[model samples]
Target: MNDDVRNIVLGMAAAGLSAALGWLARTCLWNRRLRRKQAFFGLPDNSESVLVVNRDAGSPDLAVHRYDVFALLELSALIKECGANADVITQDAARQGFGERTEFCVGGPGSNRRMAAHMRAMLPGMRVNVDSEPGPDRLAFQIGSERYRLEKGVGEYVVLARLTTGQPGRARPVFLFCGQTAITNQAAARYLYRHHERLARKHGNSTFVLLLKVVNSQAYGPDVTELVADVTRAAQAPLPTTAPARSSHRAP
Candidate 1:
């Protein structure tokens, strides 16, 4: 072969090799990210999950709020991206036991009976005033010493939690996107989708609860959000117990 031809062929080979190596590197990085996300979400590849939603209060038919519905769509997309199929069910229809499937529950206690049960069972420290009069603070969410009240059009608080089902071994995860309003619920789900990597890094695919604040949502929508607090410990802490009435039936 001529010297010029040999040099050109060698350069082409080097370029092809480099291209292959670069592609391999990119694939490895992408696979690593996908694996991390799957681990944090506890969704095995090609698995099934539940997407529990709340029923609209004022709707004659069983219609959910547009914002909550949008949040559910975002959550559904996220779950699909994470390689799981979600079966969307309403709070009344979500009667399955936990520790079986990965769940993405949206809505506050007042709107979602399943969420209300979760509050009583899993997050006892969280007290939601659902039966109170209709007002800004009607559905106040209190944890520890802080009370989050909804100020319409201005600001609202949402609680996003990635927790276990309180099983003996909490291997399954349930992501809760709960808030005062539907807009805040959407914000909470968006925050989870956008910040799962950061959350996984900090919490390591484990149980965690966060309080997020949405500012001027009427103007900016659910995009303007800030982390108010990490209420993991407080939200899951057991509620205070009263020493029973001297055990009326002790050792009968």
Candidate 2:
């Protein structure tokens, strides 16, 4: 009887040990997958994120434009979803060292020079031009053969791009949301935040660029925005031997 009781106790201990090890293994595997999914959206858990906003010193009364504020809010919400926090900074405060961490640069070349520099380096084919005359509808963006113009009653265009600068294991990703006008900027930010999961599933840890069209510009904010094109594959393709000259014609 004593031998039988000892044998039964040993069997129960072995079973409990096996169950605990299985549970631990499953938990570790699940956590690894969750981290990979989060990284696919450029938001790794426990990582630092920065949202660079354009600062208009010319308009001292208004430190940051309303459109930039809207973009900041959208990005902040997304960062929170990633189980991390982001620090919001002005364009003037942004510097080179930021490339080491994940960053979201909001606004256009005319507004955020840092974003413009990165755009020129990472996306040589895309261009954002501002009319010298400066009118209500003088801003335009061009990508490949497609050109988008801002019209008072029609709508505006914005570019949302994700880029990296290192090898697969050590790459630093940056998200750029820019537009010729403030309304377009807001639209792009909203689109990225709303469709991040879908985009992550499609891109799967790759760099991508998207052009979004904001319809009913005169109406409600980003609610009317739509996807115009997915230029990721094209933008990532190697550029031609000779770069094409910038177009000067204003969009009709």
Candidate 3:
């Protein structure tokens, strides 16, 4: 073969080999690393939590339903009803007008159900789930029930508060919060690292816990007081005293 033709053939073969190697490297070697990282972080194996969730869903203003917006709004309302300067634990409601008390986070690497368990153990009486699905805020779940539900496109906050008359174990009752609730309270650095160990134990990935000092203020809207009163009353009632009903915690 002519020298020029021979050189052209050799160049084409080299390019093909390079492309094949690159594809192999990405599919085999890099893929393994990704799987290991997921295991290390204890991230969910499902497409929803692991792949579908947009991690960078934070913004300077406004919040989304599946994101941290709902959590922020709910916590803000709670602060209004509980009175300012009261410390509270939250999952994602940090900064903005309403100050956060403290938070316990679960999910991701090092976050797991254990975090939820610890929080549950710490504050069994506070597992109040505010159901916002139906119009006119209502309280759902009674003692002995394990799961609770919240409405989509509805904004509300759920606090697992300890109703015991005395102080909680440790300096303050650790209010553990989770889910996509940490969008508004973006500046809770101190609270985020306080109980990280607990989060890590519960989840396989890096989990975060924030201990914030709840402060009193009019940061929340007018409907907060009524909602807070409703949930408190419902939680205090005996399990079988009344039938569980659907109620709206807020409108719009």
Candidate 4:
């Protein structure tokens, strides 16, 4: 071959090699990222998980909120991206123990009875008035001396938690999305999906409970969110029920 033809051939070969290397690097990085996400979500590749949807306790027809539905759709997409299957079930239909699968529980006590029961059984110390008619007068959440009330369009709060059992054999994680309203719940779910890496770095696969605040939700939808507090300790601890000295404990 002539020198020009040889140079052209060599240039094309070099370009092809570079493109192949770039593709390989991207594939590796993508795989690595997926692996980390799968681990963080505690769902192995193609393994099954549970997505627990909640119904309003007072609803006559047992309807799930639209925003909650949006949150679930988002969650479902995330699960699919991680190569995991989520068996969707309502809160009333959900059985105890989560049955060896990573379970995602969506709703507060007023919306999901299962979540209410979980709070009663697992998180006794934290006071939550989720069943009440939400307003400034009614206490939405109380942790120690601090109180949070739902202001609807103005501001709202949600509880995002990754609950892990101390049982000997259970390896799966339980994610709790307890929010003041459906919008807040959606925000919390989005936050967890988006920031799972940061959360995994800080708290690992272990238990973590956080209060997330959603400001001006009407304007921004579920996109705007802020981490209010790390209430892991207070949430997991048992309350002093024997003496009704200070805080008013409301039943779920």
Candidate 5:
């Protein structure tokens, strides 16, 4: 073949490969989302007491979390479906040594903007709250139906449910959901956490353990019934306290 023709053919092949890879990646992500959704709504198992934790490291704050990002997205959708109130907060809110913290900061618009950008990156096409001239001491984002304010901070993935009574870290039957990279196996407990030891150590909010199956270690979207079973088993376990804590936080 002529040199130009050969080059053209190679370019076409590369483009085709790129397109295939993109499609495969998208499909994997979508399938994972669907599975988590099924678990969230009890579609497959008809269980309502399941708690989900999501883990992802693409945050603008780069928090250390437990589950995968995709799982969290699905968990959010699930919470809305169940008509339950859910909120995301910084892991620092769970820090032991920190005397006090503010949910909304008076002088942290820039941080809010960065957090918004991170959310946009993680969840494209979803409506985000980005205040250009936000009021002083404003929060960054809200999750689920209740519009509870969410702040970005260090650590792993967790969706804190607000308790009527004011208590810190007292949520019960806490279900952690996380979105793991199919290839990386880098969920909250995996190797991805090594990078954020400083933030995790600084705050005590990084103590979340998640369970997910390696769907694509060889073949993508394999059965997660066992993983789901594991989650159910964990949910069946008794929680430390029944009274939910007022400290709503998130780390993924």
Candidate 6:
């Protein structure tokens, strides 16, 4: 081959090689970021985890709420993305040993005692209040001075929290996707799965809590959750003497 032709061919090959390497590097960085976000939620690759679903004990058929089921499915998909498989268990069937494993708890304080107890112990500032009267406005979840209530034909609110228990060397991570209503619960789970990477970047591996407002809740389900507040002080703050008082008015 002529010298000029040989030089041109060699340059083209080098450019192609460089492009391939650049693409590979970008892919690797993206995967690394995803893995780091997954790890922040205690979902490590090739790990076994547990999903504790809540069912109403009063129901004879052991029926679960529709939104709870939705949350379970969405969260399961997120776990799979981390290359982990989770064993599904109802709240009644979840035993003491389940606490040792990485867990994702679905439902509100009224339905899931395991998650409620954890919230009380780990995140004492937040509380779920069910109204004594039976009506559409019967439920609300409170955080400190703020109370998020359900308005008929309007919207609802939910809480998403990540916590770690056990010893430092062998900490067991637990995620809480809970709300006053099932719709809100599903919204909370959806928010976490959708924006977990952003959350991981903001908080790193530290424990945190989020309050999300679900707009047009009756129509859109989880597609319209707006961030109402995000709290990161629960892990370091001292426990309060009493839970926040329930407000009779709706959140403004």
- Candidate topping TM-score: 1
Tens-digit lDDT track for model 4 on 1-252?
999999999999999999999999999999988888887788888898989999854578889889998999989999999989989999889885743788889988877887888788767776677546645535377764556777777678889988777552357888889987888889999999899989988987788899888888889999989887898888877765553344432212
In model 5, which regions exceed 4 Å deviation? 1-67, 95-171, 177-212, 217-252
For each candidate, give its TM-score against the true structure: 0.90, 0.76, 0.29, 0.88, 0.25, 0.85
Scored by CA lDDT, what does every candidate get? 0.82, 0.75, 0.33, 0.81, 0.32, 0.75
- Superposition error at 35 for model 5 (Å): 22
lDDT of 5: 0.32
Off by over 4 Å in 2: 1-37, 56-62, 135-137, 233-252
Candidate 2 per-residue lDDT over residues 1-252, each given as its tens digit: 699999999999999999999999999998875676578655677777888898652475537888778888988887887788788888878875635778889888877888878877788777666555765435676666555666644677788888876556575688888876777787888888777768878876678899877777776777788777888765555445564454432223
- Looking at model 4, the pairs that clash are none
Off by over 4 Å in 3: 43-117, 120-252
Model 2 clashing residue pairs (backbone)? none
**After best superposition, candidate 2 residue 122: deviation in angstroms?**
0.7
Give per-residue lDDT, candidate 4, residue 250: 25
Cα displacement (angstroms), candidate 1, residue 246, comes to: 33
In model 5, state the lDDT of residue 122: 30
**Model 3 lDDT per residue over 44-138, tens place:** 13311111111222344332333333334444443333233323323243332111122323221112233334435443333333343543323
Residue 180 lDDT, candidate 5, scale 0-100: 22
**What local lDDT score does residue 59 receive in model 1, on the 0 to 100 scale?**
72
